[model samples]
Target: MAISEKELLEAGFSNRDVDTLLERLSATGGTMQGFIAALSRRFR
Candidate 1:
């Protein structure tokens, strides 16, 4: 994904949370859709 820290902040995640999300992205094979799906798993 081509996301920046600025974009992540603008999306409402804190700096610390952005790192966590980035790590999650890596764990899920680094696709934005994979990231969203991982997040969905958390809320479900």
Candidate 2:
């Protein structure tokens, strides 16, 4: 399932957070897995 802004927001993330994620994804070759890994490191 593709993660949507609305879905992330519903999951308690703010728009700025979502935007930062997208920016990071783009920086890291736009890979979802990379974004996920980055997030994992963040909440750890």
Candidate 3:
């Protein structure tokens, strides 16, 4: 199941973070796991 924007917001992500995540997913073909990996790399 895909995570919703409401879920992200409720999970503590800001609006900008949500937008960035969506954009990243779109740019790389939209996988939530991949997005998480990329996000992890970004922070590390």
Candidate 4:
């Protein structure tokens, strides 16, 4: 995963949570680009 350890740590996720979230994202066909795009739209 391109998701950095620093980014995950800064976001306050434990290593375990990061693994679980990544699994969910990948299973749902989520890429980093798609994830960011979705977040932007939802938060905007």
TM-score of model 1 (CA atoms):
0.51
**Positional deviation of residue 11's Cα in model 4 after best superposition, in angstroms:** 3.0
CA shift of 9, model 3, Å = 0.2
Each prediction's total of clashing residue pairs, residues at least 3 apart in sequence or on different chains, is: 0, 0, 0, 0
In terms of TM-score, which candidate is stronger, 1 or 3? 3
Better structure of 2 and 4 per lDDT: 2
Every model's TM-score: 0.51, 0.62, 0.65, 0.56
> Global lDDT of each model?
0.77, 0.78, 0.82, 0.75
Give the residue spans of candidate 2 off by over 4 A: 33-44
Lowest lDDT block of 10, candidate 3: 30-39
Candidate 1 local lDDT, 1-44, one digit each (tens): 55577887998989899888778778867876666667779999
Residue-by-residue lDDT tens digits, candidate 4, 1-44: 35565697788989897788679888997776676577779998
Residue 33, model 4: lDDT of 61
On TM-score, who's better, 2 or 4? 2
Q: Which structure among the candidates has the greatest TM-score?
A: 3
TM-score of 3: 0.65
Instruction: Rank the models by TM-score, top first.
Output: 3, 2, 4, 1
Candidate 2's TM-score: 0.62
Rank order (by lDDT, best first): 3, 2, 1, 4
lDDT of 2 by residue, 1-44 (tens): 36677888999999899899889778867876656676689999
